[model samples]
Target: MAVHSSDYPFSAFPSPLTTSPKVPNPESQTPSPAAAAAAAHGGSAKKRKSGLIECQEPQGGGNSAGESSLDLISWLPDEVLGTVISLLPTKDGARTQAVSRRWRPLWRAAPLNLGASSDLTDQDQKRLVFVSKILSDHPGPARRFSLPCMRLRDRYAKINGWLRSQTLTGLEEIQFGYEIEDPLLHYPLPPSALRFAPTLRIAYFGYCDFPREMAPLLKFPCLKQLNLCGVIVLEDVLHSLLCGCPVLESLLLEGNVGVGCLRINSPTLRSIGISVSCYGTRVENPILLQDLIIEDAPCLERLLPLYPIRGPLTIRVVRAPKLEISGWLSDSITKLHIGTTVFQKMIALSLTTSMRSTVKVLALDTFGPNLDSVVDFLKCFPCLQKLYIKADLQKSRKNKWSYNPLDPIECLESHLRQVVVMKYWGMRPDVDFAKFFVLNAKVLKKMVFGCINNCNDNWMANQHRRLQLDNKASQGVEFKFRRGSCSISLTHSRHKQDDPFDSHIFADDA
Candidate 1:
């Protein structure tokens, strides 16, 4: 075959050309044996020189065979690849299905890194399918799976199947957030799925519903931590479900879904955090707390009784050692929390925990009802060190002291070391508490008056100015006011339409 120069022009050479196979051009003058043999195979070389030689096309990307043989995700270095794959929204990632069979399975192999975010777009479906398929085909269990904003019933069914399929492999963590439309049909966890998910350690459910039966809980004996946010659960079913999980250590419940008096009976419970909000209508139903019977949790260490119903919190923690709580408090117990309603519940706390010796940190909303109650709380915690009074003096509750109000708790002035007056406007009571601290606490180191609301009045500003100056003048009782720590905005009131400043206002999480 006398191959001519016109037979294969230079234009036919591969774009971004490479001469690797050592094929001699037949157009050369010498009839070398190699050139003749190469010419014989030049047809294959020409096909190779055409666009077919590209490992990956500039526009189309991976070729069919390359796509079939190469696992796109597998070609990705294990550590760096997961990061790259995670960027593709589930929907786009699942489009790997069209890439090749190898990549189809590779997309499924990427680790499920679910974050706690509410943002979900239509593109998330592809990535979700990739994750679902991977979990389905995976030989073992998925350690972490986050399905946020999962709304469809079919998706739930597939997820339920995926979870069941992975049961023997041991799922470590599962987070599911979905809006429940038809509770019975959409949110059913089969008995097999539940029983097999014994390896689950942490589970978070958002805007979900648990049926009255709660038969699925019998299988969750290993569940240690559970977070239920924006969930409406039946009262009777809640108690039964909680009691069934003997190993439950930490529990968090937020928002109101009609949960009355929570009677927790878990023996292994170490910490309990609750934030229950009560936003009522015109009709006032008595704020009822799900009764928290303390007799059950013997090993309980930290108890956070957050915005419970407007009632006395009766946690018989005479048994548990340490308690850490926050939010609106009733006087039935004396502890650390924000707001003054704790003073209302003060009378109950006085009679209950009289034996308690030390309260190291105390944050008060503002003195309320009885100065004697304040004295009572201080007296009970004789070894108190840090006292934080987060009071809005402009919103102070009025009460006429019957006895010499300042005399009994005069010891507080001497014993307390650190006293913080938050939202201070340098009112008489504010000055009085500050002056009392200056005169009493002999070893007091720092006295901070945080004035969130700016006091333009010269006299009010000078009062704090003088206190700081006078403290410097005397034995140098260090006094300072750090600005911008809190907002000066007026809070909305439920009582008066004209009066925006309602001093009696107590935040639900007070």
Candidate 2:
């Protein structure tokens, strides 16, 4: 899936200086038309006529056989040709015209996938020209367009004009974001941009202010995935926008300023991610969003609120019978933070309700692994399969659960398959906690341990020796260890479970 710049469709074409004339062997009885033409024009004369002509000239008699022999790939169907060109970058795809006259038309009609990164030198000017030329000359359907973290102050008019063009009618995905350094600058999205593309399925915008006047016309009938990061928009405007997309599935709102409260009632919405800024720097008087009410969304699977909810926040899951995976769930709202208390409350609440059987995957951030508390916490989710625990092993060890040799948690003996422990240090509490799982958890397949900040050879060897001493209940269980400046990540085995919510708790802070 990694794309190399040198692997472009037409990048292999020989240069004029390197291309040698096809010399007709005088010993051969018969000569091809191209060879005959080369003889007639003289070898040196044919060499002087540019690489394109020399490479594309028909051999034999310019018939089907000649065309097939000269350029077999050109004989490929137009649909196939377009597909091949579409895989290349926009600039590279455009350069295919130099390959042959047959490719010129194919390149013109190929589905455009334009992407320009800010890291590229003179990217702003180059993007403007490149986009302008592609849109103006080709006038073909575009599939994806991305301009991430670019300076768009001077080129906004041109970008707006291009978005308004009819060539983008077939666009399915669009990602646009402004320069990160300029926080005060806000680029307003043109109404015509989204309005024209009924085929748009995914849209991501960053640092762009939503125009309130165009809220009514912001209907995206085919949009399924929408991500608005660092964008300023009112709660009502966001509600109106979501209301229009009857089939919106995945939504990610990160560091959005204006929206105080979020209410989602879409039956088609499956995954919702919200990360509100607690710094209180963006908006003058930011609303302390009180409630997040999910109504009538039976298909809702993943609900991830990444950061801690600043003020008194209430989350109510209503009419979502199929709601399964919820990130950072808590019973009592103590600034909506992640800890042992929050997890205890969540499990307790689930145990008291019908969500106990439905909830499968759980992610928690704990101070340290307390065996009793962990067992009691997990007992609530009867069908729990995957458990992600981020614990600081350096903290003090505490035993919350009374060790009972006869009794065991039902999940560990049955459903639990994978366990991922992050930020693991070679401490007594960490080893003891891990040993508890090793000697228990009949169905456990994999256990991963990661140490982010410190990973000395002594620490690793000691932990390995300690864990291996304990007889693992599951013979198939595998242990993985990763240590470096990056976050430590460990997983026992790979399962085909569908994880809708991507954990960003560590990612945001790390």
Candidate 3:
């Protein structure tokens, strides 16, 4: 759903403008009150004036409705308009002063949103100099400060100076040290950033050169969410960082983890997302984690490896019985050690692994949509209820759903209720995979298909007939088909503000 603005998009007054004012909605009918008055009262000006005397006269123009042609925005109070301007980029926000006299003081008075590149026109200008000027001009109390590190190759001290500036005195959220556009942009953690340790609630930084032997007392008491992407910190320093955040709830570790194996033992932590390399991309001097052992996370609920874009990772759960949802499980995973069972390459190899009755929601990022491997997972997770699968056909063509009708998987027969299949191209392989649930999932309540490759009217008809929806085992199951994809990927960041497992947030990222 998109927000709508009541004011017209065009300027209030225009030269050679016609009497027919522009109406934003083509379906809406806006009658000019003045024109109607002329027709109804036989051009009686006195009667129209008497009827609408209390209404303010439109100063300049309006739509063809014979109402005020005013911009309507100028009528908003200073605080409301200032807040809107404050949310804009620094360059655009400052330019709002040119709108009118009422807007001149709003930008400077409102909270500062300083992005160094904004408002700078000269390509040759030094990054530090331009950022410094903005800080010097704006008053204290910054909301968000972003410094993009391009090929300028600036020193870390530049960022240190910005963090120390008075403009960001009480600022809490900071994203610095690295730039995604320049993957090679690595910098050492500046000492100035520790100033916000007591106040920061959310923080993100990458490509940092962590100093050895972090002080025993370093901490972030207010931080609830943290991301150290590509920040290669040693095992001891990583331990100190986690210990300091006594209330930290979410953590994201991307590539360059700088540790071979990680042991987590947090009381308040609830969510953890790791992104590692799945396709063996050659990352320069990458130090990715191979093993993640949750020794004791009592409050943990979600353990997600959003994507395999970073490097290989193997997860072993030691004591997170509260862990309810986990995945984006793909080929990048070397092992998933839960209880006594060991799952490698999307299939359980060890029969000794105990059943995971606590795991209710499972997400799979599979290349083949291989139901045979999924059946093995069902045997391990008998109580699983919600399944989110993003299946592709480019690879893993060898595995097939070779289950016999006489035998049954525990999840398919009773527990599995809601199944969401993403990026489904209704080919023979996909049709067979989906039809399996329609015929076998006796307790199924809803099945959502996001089809793209073959989604025309005729294709949908063919899929409907092939799926045999009429004979679905679940009597009242809701079968929905739409032309799109869903997100099975999860990344812990402010960029994705909502819960990663939310169905409302899904779209093609899978």
> How much is 173 displaced in model 1, in angstroms?
1.8
- Any residue pairs clashing in model 2, and if so which? 33-60, 372-401, 446-492, 447-492, 448-490, 448-491
Cand. 3 Cα-lDDT:
0.66
Q: Rank the candidates by TM-score, best first.
A: 2, 3, 1
Residue 280, model 2: lDDT of 35
Against the true structure, what is each candidate's TM-score? 0.59, 0.74, 0.71
Candidate 1 C-alpha lDDT tens digits along 1-510: 233333312112322112211223332243332233234445543443344445533222334454423322223333333333333433333333333322344334655433322322234454454444445444443456566556656666566665566423566666766755554443543333344346778777666544556543555678898777666566776676676676888776665355676766666886665655542331145244444555556565445444334332444343443433222334433342221212334542333343243335544444332333455656655556566555445436432333344554433544566666666666555665566556556567766666654545675567756454455313645666655333222211111122211222222111
TM-score, structure 1 vs. true: 0.59
Clashes of 1: 21
Ranking by lDDT: 3, 2, 1
lDDT of 2 by residue, 1-510 (tens): 333435333334433211222212222343432233344445433343443354554322223434434443443446655766665555555555554555556667778777665322244565555556557776768888787776666767877887877787778988887775554555777665666436889888877777787777677889998888778787898899898888898887777777767888897988777665632354567654556777678788776655433222566665666656655443333333221123333333233433546667776655566555456557756677887766656467764344464776778879888777766665678777877777777889877665664556776677778876357889898776656322322111111126632333333231
